[model samples]
Target: MNYTLHQLQVFVKVVQTQSITKAAEELFLTQPGVSIQLKNFQDQFDIPLTEVIGRQLYVTDFGKEIAELANEILDKVQAIDYRTAAFKGILSGRLKISSASTGKYVMPYFLSDFLKEHPGVDLTIDVTNKSKVIQSLENNEVDFGLVSVLPDRLKVDEELLVVNKLYLVGNKDHMPKTAKETKEIFNQVPMIYREQGSATRLIMESFFERTKIKVKKKMELTSNEAVKQAVIAGLGYSIMPLIGIRNEIYNGELQIVPVAGFPIMSDWRLIWLKNKKLSPLAVNYLEYVRTHKADIINKSFSWIDLAQKAHKH
Candidate 1:
């Protein structure tokens, strides 16, 4: 029927306290006003809401069911109001993000700068393997992700962020002199590799497949940092994003080896659900990345080159 929210509100309040006077006090209305509103509510529904049993109000089964619906409607209204205010830029909110392990090295720098500019926005960053990041995005657990290798199915929409070249990185002392030397060293050394579902591992694998050569792996780890550490400790060499290993290579802790017949690289993407609703703030963040996409890629590779030179004897 045609019932107003005010009537539902009064009915809910009276049912909650089981006392007209108490409901009126809570609602800042006189007892008679609450009683009148409750009567109008019941009249609209063609049902009796409560019966007086020795001055105590007891709700009917129908009344309880209707009150449940009322509560749900009120909750939805409140949520709408909150979202409306956020859209107006009056309320601040947090955006949850997930990213592949390699992103941990560069994504945070970009986020920190963004947060500095938008003090009203909050952020939560989850750094994990590429597979987990994609899984989280698909499960609707995170608003966005920075991923290395995306699914071929293209179930999500992605913004091109950067182009990254893969490098066979290792400790400076164990650096290879040429592509042949690199392959020989790879065959001899204990090669640390990323776990399955890793974009870095996939890139390396595809390169090997193209060249008709298989490089044996000595260890498999989930953490990109762990792989970097192992390589620095002379355990083995591994493929990694140039941006990620810049510092170590520049500091003479790691060396970059060019593989023969392989110059494989992948595009970094900022991804989100194709069908999910994006908040205004989330859209703003994506736009910011698009504006600086080229700069970000150039900066990443620039560091790689400088780091490679520093590692030279």
Candidate 2:
């Protein structure tokens, strides 16, 4: 019947991580500290909140329900704290962004500086598929949407950050040996595909159709990392954003094969409804991204241009 907010926070984190040690790491507490708090909190309840079986922790159904309520409580507590900071004349409020899954590779770089400049700002970023990202925009659920391919249905203002180029990549063994071989490479190498609604998958499909290249679908995955790992493991070749797979290419685990017509280009843009009322926090974030976009690209994404050039020939 009696519990502290810290106890609730620790319990919710334990429920999320399913391990006292993992929860301790995230909370920056010692393992024994987390375990003691979890134990003390659980002792207040008659029914078991968590159970240990075969040395693995599992949250009971009631524990999950309680953790959800605890998370909501924490969020409200944060909102109150931010409001108090605003009262003290500090810039503080929520800045929410919904981004397409692949945009994950770029969005963080764009946000890092703004977040550092506004310590009081609360950020909620949803990284999902293009459809859900657009749907979130349409539903007015977020202040901005980060997308590589613009949605035709949305009438939005955009901050164009950087050029997004999708390249055909495979392990070294599957690469084309000559310019002529580039046109015929798909005949031998199987293709790994992103899930149906991803912009990458859509662009790759359109390219294949337009070029009349027969593709053998090796498998379909729901995200960029999954497809990239599949390609790295020699499962199949994939059309991936060079931004996401740059490290693998540098490490020689993947190679960009120059197709006769390749590197499908698009722009990653931060979009907001043309006339949506802007929150102060959102406005500041907008200014921050618009002003620092070039610097962020030059510093964090300087490799993109070089990579493109290497495979352009």
Candidate 3:
């Protein structure tokens, strides 16, 4: 019972990461330091919080319970800190965000103004696949999560930030210039595909399913940049978000295929757990995004028009 908040924080990190080494690296503590704290924490309760099997960390049922309670305690502490800082008219705290990999192209525009306005805030942004982003949000590991696909299983509050429009793109010489020709060509040409679990890939698959077209996937790449490069090399076509490919399209390295049912639109959303109480800093950020989302999204995508003009000239 005589445990410090730091111990609880470390324990929660350990549970979330499932690695003492990873937890230490995240907390900026030595690996042995984290191990000692975790041991002391378990000794206080006289119950094993975690077990290691085959070099993998597993949280016991008791550990899971404690970790949930630790999260609650930490959330409340953060709320209190936020309240105090609000009273002083000074916003200062950490803002942790986990975003789907594709969100990297858009989130910086949304955050750039906020970060400049709140100079005292410490910010951390983690970009990963959509599944991991949702996992982080479910565990309350981040203040907010940015993704295009909303999870159905988790109860969350979400705000639609922008529309992510995906386009079928390929080398200009190879892609057909009209929707009819592109549709006819789609079944014959090999396509570069985003790796499984990508939001873009999922959307593309749904489009193909609806259109009843069987695509010949030539390569599966893990990142957007890789997919673009493969397409540039004449490997195949890919469905890519316009936000991520404006530069390439403008530079004449790639062009959007005017395929039927092209430009699949998906909603990009900012989400957090519905029942969890947000700190003042978090609330401020959420409110700012809600109020200025239109402007932020407009500015973020203004390049699309410019890119088109550049391509024309």
Candidate 4:
């Protein structure tokens, strides 16, 4: 073979640990054996893959390039192993995922149950806005992303998970006194906005345009928690995911306001690379969501309704 899989493994280990001795300990090999394997790979390539910085090993630029490719190759090899195990009736492995902010409201609820049923699978989650989550998906930093915004030129495979309504929220105490009064004050109160490129902001803006309404924004913030806190603190009012603010509404911290002519809807999407292979763990986790999404949504709506009723009481 080119340098043998063991040589590549040794080289990757050294690059990852940045210490030949650590790599040797991790790989259950002697330090000399690890050094020899690395040297063999370097000899095959006719250039040093790594260099010594003081006593620490540093990966050369060429080594970094190979390390990147090596990660992909290793991922593919693990995928093959997962596929074989799946064929023989096993579901296991790690599944890294990313999601937009609003997805945080619903994804955790579903993911918790999914994890309960599939204890063998490890899960990692990164919560961010639409743009960064998509970027992470594109960079292969995550296996898939749950997003509310769909880009024009999506370079990934996507499936609609569930669609949820966006809502206009304000502190009940600041809810314009009455509906007509609210309309007049709506333009007066500062409209709090999420950071730019937020799916919620995009949807809200699109809704305003279609309804021919101009909302005056008082300020902008980067987090749902911050936006909700500002609204509750009576600093300004804003739009947010209905599901996300259910608890706040129930606790009388926020109010859901209805716009006369505006429709607020967002589709939550599950996205992955177009030609990438999914490990069994990812496939099963996704399948679990697909099968139970309706029930999940229903349960969520029920909770919100209950919260609303309690608030009214």
RMSD of 1: 12.8
Q: Which candidate wins on TM-score?
A: 2
Q: Which candidate leads the pack in lDDT?
A: 2
Sort by TM-score, top down from the best: 2, 3, 4, 1
On TM-score, who's better, 2 or 4? 2
| Per-residue accuracy of model 1 over 1-313 as CA lDDT, tens digit each | 8788898899899989999999999999999999998888888766777888998899999999999999889767766765766787764456789988888876875566668777667678998888888888878988898887887654899887666667777787976555453455566556788899888888878877776766777889887888989998988888778778777866889876755533357777788989889987788888878776667657554565565465343
Per-residue alpha-carbon lDDT of candidate 4 for residues 1-313, written as tens digits (9 for 90 to 100): 3877788788889998999999999999999999999888888775667999789788899889988887778778777876776677767677888888878876787788877876556678888898888788778888889888777676788877666766677888877755552345466667989898788888878877766777788898998889989999998888777778876876788887655542366678888988888865677777887898888878765665454455334
Clashing pairs in 2: none
Q: Per-candidate TM vs. native?
A: 0.66, 0.80, 0.72, 0.68
CA lDDT of each prediction against the hidden true structure = 0.78, 0.88, 0.85, 0.78
Model 3: lDDT of residue 266: 84
Better of 1 and 3 by TM-score: 3
Cα error of candidate 3 at position 215, Å: 2.4
lDDT of 4 at 212: 71
